[model samples]
Target: MKVINLFALLFLLGCVVSCSQPESGITNESIAIIPLPDSYELKPGTFYITGQSSIGIDTSDAEMAALANYFNEKISDATGFSLPVGNSGTIVFQLGDYKELGEEGYRLSVLADKLVLNAYKHHGIFNGIQSVLQLLPAEIKSKEIQAHTTWSINCVEITDTPQFAWRGLMLDVSRHFFTKQEVKRFIDQMAEYKYNVFHWHLTDDQGWRLEVKSLPRLTSVGAWRAARVGNWWEREPQLPTDSLSYGGYYTAEDIREIVEYAQQRYVTIVPEIDIPGHSMAALSAYPEISCTGGPFQVNVGNTFYTKTENSLCAGNERTFEMLDSVFTEVTRLFPSPYIHIGGDECYKGFWEKCPKCKMRMQKEHLKNTEELQSYFVKRVADMIRKKGKQVIGWDEILEGGLAPEAIVMSWRGVKGGIEAAKQGHSVIMTPTDHCYLDFYQGDPIVEPNTYSMLRLQGCYKYQLVPDSVDASLIMGGQGNLWTESVPHYRQVEYMVWPRALAISETLWSDAQSRNWKFFVHRVEQQFRRFDLSGVNYARSIYDPIILPHLDKENRLKIELQTEVEGLNLFYTFDNTIPDVYSNTYTDTLTVPKNASMLRVAAYKGQKQAGRLIDITIEDLKKRAMEPKK
Candidate 1:
């Protein structure tokens, strides 16, 4: 038997192979990614193997270079391979478009002499990498390496692409500014999960995070705020020492770079500029645009549900002109097909009382405040379409009248998406119940802070398409991370991973071909990916937190929350064989994970679920270690 030197090899390849479906459910064989034209071919090799990238070396950005090198080293270390000297003898894996099937199609084909890695774009490359990680042996997957060989696979054909045209992740940067590098790091993580869209919440009541050439103060004044004394969630008294300088916006060049990087990965960045509502950030810098024309600070409180005075007046031509200029600059910066106009939770109390708003509503003959919001959305949608772009907004966009070209994102639930699709408009699913990552995965009593209801398995088992809806109007789905509470990068990583892996499988895998047992095994393999990569993940406490509620049928039901690709769920009364049809959950599941015969399920999408977890009472006792006081 050959001894596996995983440490050295894994460190070289920069990834650790964890688990694989062995013939008898246990074996130690090193699985190496053999580059094929359309897919990866598994080879049982004894020598050390390393994955090399064409990305040139840079010294100035040592952290970036180190990250790349670390990946290379880990893969090699796990496989017991030595780094090639002077780039000679390194397997030259050529990256190209492997569109043998269609968009998002990929394949690893092995011809006579070398390996070829091909995909539609960078995101495909990311997916291919995850797939390669799956083929590795289990010991390598679970933070250990094993030795065995005789890897083989029947030549198979795969026609794969994202389930939803828009698989996205939203990040709210207005509340807290993350460096450009931090943003890029987040993008890297998103790509790893095969999420193809990045919804950037760039502006909010806390601060403005984009620079408009015409609106100088937007960055100069609006972006900078007096030092925030306390957490927005906590009602601590403002400290006198609270100073007036606490933020920065992205420069056009910065955005251009970010856009290019995302483009390389086939990820579109949808930037949101709140209109009519969430305008405090803008009004803070340009007081002239406000009907009151008084100095305003970045709204520190949750005034959205309570106040009505901040609404942009439709009667004011300057309001339209300002929006025109902002949209013009925004359109020029982001070439995405759909621009997001936040239309959720706008308090109409201000519009009802404002002279400019009342007069304008009368002039336009709008029936009510809802119609006015619809009008505002349509006006922006019109401007966006004039520049040749579509528009997407929250469920609130459906309130007044959805523009023909506007796509509705059903964050509230499938009702909006179903309604919008029935109306012939495309819809992206982002129902907060399943896709909000900011929620606590474990019991709130155990791990307090997050407001979302998401857990690892919940993220894994999620289906972007509701069962009753027609498939034609479904554009795709996305996960949102509204960082009212997440203040650091590590927190972001903790909430996203494993779950994002589930999402990847969900988005990429075919709906009909899922097996829960296989998915659990796959996630088991991915644990090595997270452990070696230093990604801190939420624990299994989440299972009991959502399971008790899911086990019963109620008006409010539970849905499998996952974004992993290629997952399947299995359940059994006897626990012998999994019934895919009867066990599937469309709403809140009332079933228990530890029931007489609860079994693992498969997720068939680009999203991935975490491990096969059995929740114990002890699970509820665990808490996320808080930062030092």
Candidate 2:
């Protein structure tokens, strides 16, 4: 009886020791922070938040105090617990002498007794606070107070910093306007991921979305366009009898509010006033500024209105004067040092036909319409410089000759970015192949109809700085969300997330730190947070991509692939919806001679995991014969 009791006691003690130890296998993911920290060390134990827990910040700094209050409010809103702000608390934020941490870097230590954040600047502290928030339970993201939720963080030490200074996301509001509240929500989500730049594409052919006080017509007339239905690219042109109103714009007050909101979140708003090209909306309001003198209407369709002469007239002095007035107001409204004057795809055909343009080109000794475009861009750059701001334009600004001080936003591809960097100009890499969030991320049949494909893995594998260019000239990278087909804010969220998450990690974490499998796991964790916050995100990573290729005998073959593992891909050649019991895909499939169509689906265990993909034999043949994009 004595021996039996001793053995039982030893077994109980062993169970206690095992329970106290940290979860087996320590990794950066043990903390589960997205855009994983530069370095981290997980320790045994957890930091518990009790009713008496408080937040401490440097009381001497006004900004720090404000940030502390902001975090306190967030915590209170989340857990229904009021965390008082004082000089001493369980959680402490202190300014440190760690100059090596840089302006946006922080050191976070989550001890069993207390949580401490150390940084040299307010930006770093803000980031450190974000890390702390991420460490909390996913229930903390809920807007409503979570009841009986355990607010605890695993003890860990993290030293974090962004790999690139410019981690950005561009939102094209011209295509589909989002309200001020929605914009704020978008910024709030971005801030959680440590994104620092918000490139606001404020103008496009579809509509002009920013208000210029001196140019009232820009918002009143340019902001609205005829409403269209169905596919954006297939929509009919606006007729005179059509109701020419289906959009909105931000007033000066609205702009000021949004700017303040973004500033509070440490996001710089870079406003893009697309020029020369994509000026149909602006020209509709002020027709005299275009090369073709006519009454123009803001485009409602997604198709490029190139034939309509949307380019601003370089020869017209009124064009310059109007631009100057617009820029004057824009510069005052936005505090960002760089203004994007879009110089992309400007159809110079009208310039070639215009007598005034020809005469101006002759007087300026310009060789071609491209040179004329360069002349216009240089002049615009000069105007921006006068306002103590720099100018950034699409890669087309490099045509003929780039403006001496203009920055290049390379959207076409990395070639454009490399060329700009070689010419001693700063470049922001946003090639469509990787950074365009509007592209279909999953199988086209399973995802919203978009022009191209950009897998999440492709985005995570992006290299911002090519080997040929100097790293200093590369300002960083951004993901562009062109909302041509996205009509609602929910759809925008679906398109932006997951892929945007990949871009965030790519821009913040070191390249060598990337592991697609591990990143997918982190994304799954974030998905829970999104669910709690009621944010829309896509789970198309499980969808299989059907790759059509020709065999050695010229027979068409279909290859199935998925970015994530453990998903069972099932297919049928008879065009029937696949189920768990369907034929499982183990290797490349040969096109059956009598097969008219193919249908594929993904499943996890007994449940359907992704959308059904349907493809015809003719479609496969056409895809196989098509030239490589």
TM-score, structure 1 vs. true: 0.72
* Candidate 2 ranges beyond 4 A from true positions: 1-29, 138-147, 302-304
Candidate 1 local Cα displacement, residue 530, angstroms? 2.3
Q: Report, for every candidate in turn, its global Cα lDDT versus the true structure.
A: 0.60, 0.83
After superposition on all C-alphas, the RMSD of every candidate to the true structure, in Å, is: 10.4, 7.9
Compose the digit string of candidate 1's lDDT tens values, residues 1-629.
Answer: 11112222222222222234233242312332211112122343222233332333233544334333433443454553433322223222223545544555555432223323345544454455444434333334432333442122222222235555678888988877777877877776676556778999998777889899998888887786655434454544234465657777899999999998777556789999877777777887887777677567775544344443555665577888988888888899998977888887776776776688788899999888889888888888898889877788888889988887788889886889988988888888888777888787764544537544676666666787777778877877888887777667777777776566666666665545344444555555455556665667664422322343311333222335433334454443344544345455445544344444334344343322334333332332222122221
User: For residues 20-67, could you state the per-residue lDDT of candidate 2 as single tens digits?
Assistant: 112232233444567777877767888887678888877888898888
